[model samples]
Structures are given as structure tokens and as C-alpha cells.
Target: MMQNFILCLQEAALTFTLKKYLYPTDPSECFINPPCGCLNPGQEFQCEDCPYLEACLSSFKLK
Candidate 1:
């Protein structure tokens, strides 16, 4: 139950960030200032399944 709750929160955060922050502004669509070197912006990037979801959320440093 607890794991499900945490995953739900992760999904919520990723969805919000993608819709409100990354997609609207960045020309590449996403991967703005990615947390790690391996991540790259692309048309097929799926934030929902990414292991770096939390890092990307924090990297936004949203006010």
C-alpha cells in the first residue's frame, strides 16, 4: 500500500512537471538540465517510466 502511494506521488509530480514546466517552454520538449549524463531529450522520451523522475523534478527547482 505504501509503495503504491509513493508511486502515485511520483506519477503526479512527473505529470505536472512535464505538462506545466518542461513541455511548454523547452524546445526539445523535455530533458532540460538533466540530472545525469545519460539522459537526453528526444521525441520518444517517456518521463513516466524513467528512473530519473525524482531527479528531474528536483532539477526544476520550481519556486
Candidate 2:
């Protein structure tokens, strides 16, 4: 069970890194919501171009 948990964590971390790279931005002023296309329901919907991303990151962590 512990190993499974760790694997899940690794997958999540990898997914987040991919998201960060795909959405690369440091400010909310530059941000735009990612278009609702292939994304799964309840997934994040922000572009990396936002000027407020760093601030938003903290909140996102809680999720």
C-alpha cells in the first residue's frame, strides 16, 4: 500500500511538472484559461501566462 501511494505521488508530481511546463508563465496578467477541449472534468484550467500564477500556486497546493 505504501508503495502504491508513493507511485501515485510520483505520477501526480510528474503531471504537475508537465502542466507547469506546458503552461509556463509567472504572472496573472499574462494568463488565460486553458480552452475546454481535451481536459478531463474538474481538472485545472489555467494558462501558464498568468501574472498571478505564483500566488495561485499556493492555493493550488491545497487541492
Candidate 3:
């Protein structure tokens, strides 16, 4: 029973970590929400002029 409990805990932790990695936190990284919203790859937005462009690009590269 204890072994099964440990396995469950490990699986939960792994799932949580994977979810965090996939979605990420504060994807916007902006103080005021822009009209276009947070930048994501393949979206039509002024990424060239965005202050968070670098961060967004890095995140997208991970995908």
C-alpha cells in the first residue's frame, strides 16, 4: 500500500511539472495587458517592437 502511495505521489509530481513546463507562468510578462494580449508564437502581433519579444521568442523556441 505504501509503495502504491509513493508511486501515485511521484506521478502527480511529474504531471504538475510537465504542465508547468508546457503552459508556463506569466506568459505575458507585461504590467498592463496589451490590447493584443500576451505574445505567442505564430500569432500576428508586433513582435518586432514588443519589449517581451525576446522572452516570447525563447518560450516559443521551447515548443
Candidate 4:
């Protein structure tokens, strides 16, 4: 029950972020991790580098 709720929230957040900033790309598109180092505009190379990790996870009830 809780897992389903969390999934719903995750989908929502990912959707919102995609809509707001990455509207040009399709959600099904998977981005490959850089072999050395690379960065997206206004985006950190990885989610681990994001300061909003805790907030985003908690908001989605992710473990």
C-alpha cells in the first residue's frame, strides 16, 4: 500500500520536473552517465550531487 503511494508520488515529481525543465525530451529517454565528466545546463551530473535529494525522496516516500 505504502509502496504504491510512493510510486505514484515519484511519477508525479519526475513528471513535473520533466515538464518544467526538460520538456524537449521524452521521459522514456535514458541518459547515459558520462565516462569522464559532463554536466547538463542547470543540472548536476548526477542525482547524488543534488542538494534536494532528501526533500525529493521524502516527498516521494522513497527508501
Candidate with the greatest TM-score versus the true structure: 3
Worst 10 residues of 1 by lDDT: 21-30
Please give, for residues 1-63, the per-residue lDDT of candidate 3 as tens digits: 999999999999999889866553565543234434544534645644565556554676677
Q: How far is candidate 1 from the true structure (C-alpha RMSD, Å)?
A: 11.7
> How close is every model to the real structure, measured as TM-score?
0.33, 0.34, 0.35, 0.34
Of candidates 4 and 1, the better by lDDT: 1
**Model 2 lDDT vs. the true structure?**
0.52
Candidate 2 structure quality by residue, lDDT tens digits, 1-63: 999999999999999889867643543322344242323323344433333444455454555
lDDT of 4 at 32: 36
lDDT score of model 1? 0.56
Q: Between candidates 1 and 3, name the one with more favorable TM-score.
A: 3
> What tens-digit string does per-residue lDDT give for candidate 4 at 1-63?
999999999999999878766422332222233222334513654644544443433444433
Q: Evaluated with lDDT, which candidate comes out highest? A: 3
Ten contiguous residues minimizing lDDT sum, candidate 3: 29-38
Q: Model 3 residue 5 lDDT?
A: 100
Model 2 misplaced regions, further than 4 Å: 23-63
Tell me the deviation in Å of residue 56 in model 2: 21
**Candidate 3, clashing residue pairs?**
none
Clashing pairs in 1: none
